[model samples]
Target: MSDGERRDMGSKLSFGRGRPGRTAVTLPDCDVPLAEMPSPSLLRDDLPLPEMSQPEIVRYFTNLACLNYSVDTGFYPLGSCSMKYNPKLHEDLARLSGFAQVHPLQPIETVQGALALMHELQGFLAEITGMHAVSLAPAAGAHGELTSILTVRAYLEHRGESRHKVLVPDSAHGTNLATVSTAGFQCLPIASDARGNTDLAALAEALDEDVAALMLTLPNTLGLFDQNIVQIAQMVHETGAQLYCDGANLNALLGQVKIGDLGFDVVQMNLHKTFSTPHGGGGPGAGPVAVKAHLAPFLPSPFVGQAANGAYVFEEPEHSIGKVGAFHGNFGIMVRAYAYIRSLGAPGLREVSENAVLNANYLLACLREAYDLPYERRCLHEVVFSGSRQRAKGVHTSDVAKRLIDYGFHPPTVYFPLIVDEALMIEPTETESKETLDAFCEAMLVIAREAEEEPELLRSAPHDAPLRRLDEAAAARHPVLRWQREDQA
Candidate 1:
């Protein structure tokens, strides 16, 4: 089949449609005594198994892979998501038999080497964040928030206090509010000032004995580092509340600053984001939560520690939050993160953050004229721009995003933080070279001009892509998750 025909016919090729009487594998007759067959009711009638020759199967998947996009393939300037290039070296180290083949159920005495890695990783994370201890239990950034919130509840209960509120900035990640609600706490929104910093007055009024924690994203959703973070932490601490730092933007501060020193009582690090692990597509993530000495007692148990014999062992905290995950939490991801840290020592990690900030600022400067920058200040790893300029020309933010697809690039985040009129959040991670940045900027410039000169092109974009604009609402509401005979035309 030709490429154009394949694209026009839809990328999903049902495995057995084109070929009949084809099989990739052939099973041999049973060599041992066979057991009695199970009941028909217990067996599935239709397994929907794909039947195809080996070559056909490989080609089908290869074609589908080409249709998809990933960080390995192109520039993914996803803001707040930190879709940076994960080093292949980390992948190699993570796949080593010593790390990859070990089962979690093995005795601690036998897996001392793995335990040692985890113990050293814990210490490295704690030292990096200026925390006393770390727990590699939570599975993702949002899960980390939930774990921290639960710990706060436990700490407040231990103090015999009834604090039930959590303060979050208006520009905070939406996950913060959801996490607070899930933890059975009232979430109050603190407004951002005109300069995109957290409104100090609003935060002051919000802080009270009833507030359990103040959840702040250091460099918030808009990618602006809160200038008054120290003051905010002090205020929250004075009111008998803990300060929880969402370490999602740690990419912008990697080796430059530590959260614990900045007065945060608890923090959660995204191993997949800042530390370079394969992430996205709702996947395998590690969000290790770190805490000060006071809150260390409430951390999740089974943490790796040095035993009296100077050997690593699993140690449980006295007043623990219980197990948040099975086993020791995404060991594969932890391995990748540990590899990343070891590969880049303190100085190299600092350079990572420095280049990230520089790249973001460069993009901001190049595209500020085309897009309206809501907060015209220096940004960290990402920058948020408004699409009101394009909208005025009858091209919405979504239009520009779709047009980017035709330009051979994935779109940056859009319509997020819910504060800007039409937000276009862009994060050019440090992994990208200057040439990629310039190409992306050139695409945006071209799109801006097209929006003015040819509004219709912007409205209906992705002209060169394999697929055109889809009915997103319908797809969401009535998702076709699997292929069936009826779907075959």
Candidate 2:
């Protein structure tokens, strides 16, 4: 049978299979007294709940799980996101009863062990980034960015300065721009020079007494380390403005260099990305912010502090920016990250960066001939390539990404950074083996060949997947969030 016929048969098997009056669970009688029922006006009896036997429900969900892609299932080379493989050991450790089952509101004396873990994690992060203090309160990367910006704002305000503008590189992450505005500051975009570094001339012009901070993403979205970072830091400080480093790309410099040593006043590290915690799926992630001594007073509140008696306690900074989260940020994620650091130590962390850089450059060397290399410099942890050549043959980067699905590999990030035309950004993180990289590269080369010889194949791709290419634009603009039975439809 054809692929379409098979898909139709599968869909038929999936839907409308629930038998009436069937139940998956048998609930025991309630032991507690029941509350009064609400009025009928507040009730709904026509909910489309599925009814199926326990075995059938298990099989259905198992099939659904098999259809999803994850870091554990295959190679994920998503560029800026750093989709690295998470160690199951860390997951098992995080699930321990003491760590997983503790309440955030428990008495401080009872949870000293958990508090000590956070205290030590803070110190480890500070040492890793060479910062004076760290706060484990921000929940995600963007939250960290917002927290850092707010801290800068508070610091400047405390000094009786009213700086209103924050300088952001043109190739910086979208969150940087949004964070600046959300912190009640104007975001000014700085142009990148021909060599893909921040334009020194434009930065000089942009800096003045009104500029609050220069947010720099080291080894920026282009994956090229800025050769003039020290000079840029000097320029920003000359105007009495602070220098903020977006440490999302710290995976490329872990154990090799510290952001604080590079003259940044503040930096935020994504524990989920670089420190090997569970990432994606709108998840429980951590983005702890670290700062130099001068700005440490404004870090988010309730950071772990060590008393002179050697007891761990939550202490607010003198001039803190106030609480950025409901509680000490995602405690489970923090535990996993703590386990990752203690397991790796200093030497292993350095190897992480070394192998990450090596794997990325290997892919760059193998694919440069087939794809367009926008910049001809050595990349740090990720490589950004342009698909303008394929676009010339009437095949776009999104088309190439869709075709990758046919080869059983997740697609790299495409058309991002908003600087390169038809961009295909790939990052083969340290966890991937050379053999996996080779197989992915081979599939890409074959797709490149098919793009030229048979452009139509690229235009309509992923023939083997369970679902064909969807109208993503329409789906985004008009989302169907609820499911309904065929009779209701």
The candidate that wins on lDDT is: 2
Backbone steric clashes in candidate 1, count: 0
The models' CA-based lDDT, in order, is 0.90, 0.93
lDDT of 2 by residue, 1-489 (tens): 456654654455445668878999999999999987777678887765668889988877776666779999999999988899999999899999999889989998889999999999999999999999999999999999999999999999999999999999999999999999999999999999988999999999999999999999998999999999999999999999999999999999999999998999999999999999999898888999999999999999988998899988899999999999898999999999999999999999999999999999999999999999998899999999999999999999999999999999999999987898999999899999999999999999999999999999989998888788888999999997866686876
lDDT of 1 by residue, 349-398 (tens): 99999999999999999999888989879899999999998898878999
On a 0 to 1 TM-score scale, where does candidate 2 land against the true structure?
0.95
Which pairs clash inside model 2?
none
